[model samples]
Target chain A: MATSSLLLLLADGRFPAGAHAHSGGLEAAVAAGRVTDLVTLEAFLAGRLATAGLVGAAFAAAAHRAVTSAGSAVRGSTLALLDAELDARTAAPALRTVSRRQGRALLRAGRAIWPEASFDDLPSTPGGAHQPLVLGLLCAAAGLSRAETAAVAAHGTVTGAASAAVRLLGLDPYQVQALLVGLASRCDGTAAEAARAADEPPERLPAAAAPLADIHAEAHATWEVRLFAS
Target chain B: MRAYARLVARADGRGGTVLAELRGETPLLLRQTPGSGRAVTVYVVGGAAGPLAGDDLRLEIDVGPGAAVRVHTVAASVALPGRPDVVSRMAVRAVVHDGGALHWLPEQLVAAAGCAHLAESRVELAAGARLTWRDEVICGRYGEAPGGAVVHTRVDYDGRPLLRQSLAVGPGAPGWAGPAVLGGAPATGSLLVVDPSIPHETAAVEGTLARLPLAGGPATLWTATAADAHTLRDHLDVEVEPLLTKVE
Candidate 1:
């Protein structure tokens, strides 16, 4: 029953964090004809999870650990370094913005339930309370391990894609939930890998690979018909 | 020579690559400077902008938590009129800490005749942070006889590969005048914006101005993989709007 509650908490799409408004780049993919069905969508989702999603998870884990170990007052440069790196890799204008929006929403939600993120308590000058930063802060408060923090990051990412799928393919919500459940292990594995490497110095970062995705994102920006915002 | 970026929370340059930390509360302090050193040396600074001479151009930025720093160029970058020397590569990098947002928006790049330039930009996102921006690379003289030009650009984001663009335009290059990368065209430009908050209808978000006018140009947009992440790609086939034509 406890596990079911956690699953429900992670699975509920209507939790009001604004996950319904974004298709990430799937909507643009659909308009551009790059994604037409579930198979391609799955491939795309898997590919992203392995790349951007993996990176996000790793950073979230590191950040969660940073908050707990480095004390509550962390340096701003640490987060900015991650943000810049994320920006450098995000080729699509839509996805970059989408991630921040979701990140922000997550932060907002975190404050109410998990006060460690302390959204209402942060210094107002630092408007850059990005989603991952908030996630890390909240995870610390939740008493979650480093691996669990990474999993949360991965879960949020899948949720973004699954939400987009419902609108793009009109797939049944139950099916999406089931697919998510089945794929949980894969996401967890990714989280574990991310947590394992969370302690690496920022200088020795890995290389990102997503060309078709970037070209599509740029082209999509020039489009005249898109269903989702990003 | 390849330029290596050193990570520093704060760098102050009185006139060049140096900068002073912001003494106030906000972490971000952005300043713009015109062309310097007859070359381009652009970097992020804390609070002020500098000038560009025949040698260098610099930017210093210090982004504090929740603070936003923006460094914009007053005009498009012009690679000196006449040049014949080793590759004049422009390298730019940034160190965005937690709770800090940096927007690097430089004007369009204008590569005139006889210009050999290699531009490189690298960024790393720590975690739970955000970055929104665009970059446009232009080749050839905007308003003069097209000249032989060469551009080799490599852009990377995060730990993955983002963009690897190699373009060579000369009289003898293969398919120089064919319907390929540039569609047998003389002058071409590319724009990339990595922001997710654009609009729900991202495909429809493109405006008429986003297109280039040409009698028979190919214009299209799609999502492809780059640096292990999905990227949106757009192609404007040398076709400028009929009403607004490119004069050379």
Candidate 2:
């Protein structure tokens, strides 16, 4: 399979990764009136992309590097450390559950698409593997490069939230697409930066944090009726 | 100026806890008194002024087995710039032994205008050790913009990585007032509790984060805003007591 086709397949919103159930904290932001218009929605997407997106891409790229750099034998310990590192980066319990839930779904899909030894060695987390960690392992199984893994990581981080914004707030789709188009260049740049750090140790991975998002996730978890799971 | 403070709380062998060692400066004050259920409450008072530029302040605290220590600050610690192109730093290291608990609820640390400050804290805990820690930061004085401040926090329980995060804001920092970041809030507070034995749903929702399950164990993290240090302290007092009492 061509690399571009593989990237499209993974990045597709309909990848059956269980990402649909999560609003990526957009539901909370909407309820709080933080994202009322197209401009606020753009700011939310960009901020999330820059912080959580970059961090996720870095970890995913590192996980992919861990498999490809080792030439065939997947090190369980390295994968385990990567899992722990991602866990450290995430501060909200609700967000971690969302990540693990999506990760389990992705792993289920990956095992069906490409059953490989690297995927077999994924460390067992309490909830499950983080979504990005599992995505990286799937990329390794698909023979995708580190940069592609990061692009997938960064692109998915904000795009899913943008889609959620549309459903939650009934925002104009054309305007949201424009916002996404405007952010495409920066998204690529973030992915490049994350891919460059793929060779760094697990502890050295990017730890960009969004404090408000973590707080919103916490509040959203307590809501009796929320549109998205996260 | 370089200053240091070390506090060690040990079991008095009489069904109570006592301060083993206490040493510091005016910038870091300590007053120990008997508290509820084998715990000693220590009130930390700041001096007339906080650490100036070029001042290195280091604080170390340890809790022995079967001991409980609770530390509270009287007022907020404001970091003032000493000289041009210089930064002030506050380093705190704490440890809790097995079957012990340490709760340090300090007031906000305000970064004065034009001042650069770095506040770093590392907490290491043994198995069965419980900790309820809270820290907050204010951008600057009221009616003023934020300065340069970076808060780095790391925690380990039973030799496992729990949480390691660095929050940077102000000029030239990423996500200054963005919606997904601080949402234009001037003050931010974080409360972390490291104890897995307690039931996860026990944390009452008072402020930002009610119950956040950290990776190392069942920890509660609340990062939100307040009007000032006093208001933030009041918000934390109501939320923190419920979580702190659950350690035993």
Candidate 3:
């Protein structure tokens, strides 16, 4: 598979990874009246991109590096360390569950598509592997570079929430796509930075946090009827 | 200016806690309020003026096995502007040995306008150790825009990472007060409790507050944002009271 085409395929939203079920915290943000329209949605997405996007991308890139560079004997431990570190970075339990659920979903898809991939190396945590780690491992299996893995991770962070915003707020889809286009360069920049930082140790990776989002996610999990899982 | 303060709490063997070692510098003053209880209470009194820019201050705390220590501050520490291009830093490093407990409940930190400040706290816990760590930040003084401020916190339990997060706000940090971050709230804080005795559960979000149990261990983190410090503290106290009482 050509690396560029493979990157596009994995980055596509229809890749059957279970990401569509989660809103990335947009449902709660909308309920709080913090995100009512496209203008506020743009601000929300930007903030999410700068913090969560950057952190997720960095971890995904780092995971990719671990799978590509580490020896087979040490790969499991390295991936476990990455998973634990990422868990530490995620303060909210609901968000953690969502990430792992997505990871489990992605793993199921990866196993069927690339049966020979190193999916066995994923840490067998109670919930499952973290989504970013799974993405990194799958990207590596598809012969994608660290930078491309970061880009996929970064893109998902915003697109998931943006798509949710359209559903939750009934905003114009064209405007939302335009908003995403405006953010394309920033998405690329964040991915590049995340890829560069992937060389650092897992403990030293980006741990940027959004306190409001953490609070929102916890609350969202409690609602009786919510549009998104997280 | 640079200052490093230290405090050590030890079990007295008579079912009480005592300060085994106490040392303070110019601004990071350590004072023990007289009390006869299982937990030795210490108040961090400000002995000097400001932790102005270019100042580096550190506080070290050690809780010996079976000892309990509670730390408090006399008043809020205001990070004032000082020399240009220099950043003010306050670091707190703590360790709790086996069967020990540490309650770090300091006053809010005011990030005064025009100041560049960095506050960091790292706590390590041995097996069976418990901790209640709280950190609050007031963005700026009244009628003033906040300067650059960053708070980094990391907690390790039994030699493994439990929570590691850094929140940056005010100047130089874009979109910090946006919908995804603080969401225009001026006051923000977090309460973390690491006690194995407490049942594992996640609390529902109440207004601007929410509690989440960490996935790796028996720990819960409650985060809140409000229009003012008093309200933020109240929101945190509501969630913290039940757990603390149950643990005690």
Candidate 4:
């Protein structure tokens, strides 16, 4: 399969990876009045792209490197460490649970579509392996490169949240699409940076954090009623 | 140009005591608190005109097994752009051995307007060790716009990464006051607690507004922002000191 087509498939918001249920904390931001308008939404997306987006991309790229690189015997430990590292980078308990749920969902899709042995090596966490780790495994099954995995990770990170913003805030879809178009270059740059660091040790991966987003995720978890899982 | 301080704590049957101490310009003063023989409190005092341009301050702290150490600063250390030729920097490294504990609560770091300062702190903890650390930063003096300040902190527990953060706040920083970043707050305070004994999701948040789970082991990083540095520091202390002192 062509790499771009496979990337397009996985990067699609409707991939059935269960990403639809999550607003990527956008619901919480909207509820908090921080994302009331288009300009603020843009700021939220830009910040998310830099922090969570970059971290997810780096880990996904690193996991892809682990699976694609030589030494098949160490793949198990490498993937396990990647899962734990991603868990550590995620600061919100609710986000951790959401990531694992999303990871399990993606794994179900991967097992059905790819049926690769690399996915079998990923140990199940109390929640599940982080979404990025599972995404990396699925990418390896599709014969995608590390950079492609990073792209998938980075793009999915913002697109899910952007789509969530549309549903929550009822913004103009065309404008949101245009904003995403403007962010395309940033997505490419972030993926490249993540792929470049893919060879680094798992512990040395980038740890970009959004403190407010984390706090919001925690608050979102306790809500009696909400639109997003995280 | 370079100031250094080292503090080594040893378990003395009942509690921990400062075993070896060394200092250059920024000295560490050891104080004894009531009812705790093993617990020692350290105060970082500045010499002369505080931290100036081109000055580098280094602090190394170690807590032995079964020992406890608490550290605080005398007063706010102003980072002045005396020469304007170089940036003032402070680097701190700390370690807690198995079953040891350390509580490091420092006063506000006032980065005066137009000055540039960089502060980095790294902490390592053994499997059974515990640490409660707090840091407060005032971007600039009261009623003034922020200068330039960057704080980078990393914590590792049992050789596993716990938390790592780089906060750059000042003019020209992208969205520094936006809701995604500091949310228009002038001062920011952070509390990092890494301890297994503490129950998960156990945090009492008051005054300040933000709390998040830490990455490594059983830890939580609580952050609060307020109109001024004093209020921010109060928020950090209110939520964190109880947890740290309970280790005794």
Clashes of each: 126, 0, 0, 3
What are the chain A TM-scores for all the models, listed individually?
0.79, 0.96, 0.98, 0.97
lDDT of 4: 0.79
lDDT of 4 by residue, A1-230 (tens): 59889888988988988898998878887887888877887778877877788889998898888888847799888888888777767766677788889999999999999874568678656777888988988898888889899999999988998888889989999999998898899889999999998888887787766667667777777789987777
Query: Could you tell me the fnat of model 2?
Result: 0.53
Q: Write model 4 residue lDDT over B1-248, tens digit each, in one string.
A: 77777888888775556555534454333344444656777777776565777778898988999888888787887877766667888899999999888988888888788777888888999998999888777878878776777777878899887877667677534455666666667888688888888777743333336667665688888877778877887777777757755666
Tens digits of per-residue lDDT for model 2 on A105-220? 99999998886445867787677888888899898888788999999999998889998988988888988889999999989989999999888877777776678788788788
Chain B TM-score per candidate, please: 0.50, 0.90, 0.96, 0.90
Q: Across residues B1-248, which tens digit of lDDT does each residue of candidate 1 receive? A: 12222323321222222223422211122333444321112333322211111222222234433443445555655454333444445555555555444555455455555554444554543343234334544444444432333433333333433333334444323233222123223434443322222222333224211321111011112222111111212333222121112110
| Better structure of 3 and 4 per DockQ | 3
Q: What are the per-residue Cα lDDT tens digits for candidate 1 across A1-230? A: 55545544643566656767766456655665555666556555665566556767877776676666764455354555555545444534554555577777876777677654544433232334445656666666666777877887777776787778877878887877777776778788888888887788543343233333444445565558777655
Candidate 3 accuracy as TM-score = 0.95
lDDT of 3 by residue, A183-204 (tens): 9998999999999999998878
Which parts of model 4 are misplaced by more than 4 Å?
A: B14-16, B26-37, B48-55, B77-88, B110-117, B143-148, B170-173, B202-215, B244-248
Candidates 1 and 2 compared: the better one by lDDT is: 2
Docking class of 3: medium
Winner on lDDT between 2 and 4 is 2
Task: Return the lDDT, model 4, position B175.
Answer: 51
Best by TM-score: 3
lDDT of 3: 0.90
Ranking by DockQ: 3, 2, 4, 1
Show the lowest summed lDDT stretch of 10 residues, model 2 chain A.
A67-76
TM-score for every candidate vs. truth? 0.48, 0.86, 0.95, 0.89
